[model samples]
Target: MKHVTYADKALFLDDDSADWLMEYARALGSATMTDTVTLRGIGMDGNEVEATFLLNHSTELITQTTQSGLQGPKNDEAVGYMQEQTRLILTPPPARSVDDPLEIS
Candidate 1:
């Protein structure tokens, strides 16, 4: 058996940037490594509300193991390790530096 894991991250944004970020997150939702978004509302408590996102990711693995290794599919162990090593943070999710060539604006 193979186990699946999920993870989430949150980012804060101002009024204008929040909208843009939300839209961007939605667009990337269908990708293999995109942020699953849950837009939070602003509060009057002087604390900035955060835009919570579940990075639709896989990491944890479930499998039967013996002395040698996993006793499942041939590539299960490799895939599981790869999944764990894969970064939950998505490409083009946010934070483009000034020197980033991919930045359009």
Candidate 2:
């Protein structure tokens, strides 16, 4: 059966402070390009202090045709797998102090 898995990494920025969230998004876009990953979306709240960026990709699936081609069970299995993976990855991390400077190695 042919299976497709879509995956995305998202970052949430708290904009209640003086930080340059747009600049951060631009930097992230450049770094993602270097790593060959596409940035899916960038959004900011009405106040411009809260922002979100989505980075996304999908898995390649290969399938062999049987007499029936693809079956319902196969499709359901693939959907379940992708859903579980997405749930695990999309859970937000614990909140941190936005006033702290980001550490770079």
lDDT of 2: 0.29
What residue runs in model 1 are displaced by over 4 Å at the alpha carbon?
1-13, 35-44, 48-52, 55-105
- The most accurate candidate by lDDT is 1
**Cα deviation in Å at residue 53, candidate 2?**
24
TM-score for candidate 1, please give it.
0.26
Q: After superposition, how far is residue 7 of candidate 2 from its true place, in Å?
A: 17
Per-prediction TM-score: 0.26, 0.21
- In candidate 2, how many Å is residue 70 off? 13
What is the lDDT, from 0 to 100, of the residue 66 in candidate 2? 26
lDDT of 2 by residue, 48-95 (tens): 122222322222212222232322211233334334444444453567
Top candidate, metric TM-score: 1
The predictions' CA RMSDs to the true structure, in order, are 18.4, 19.2
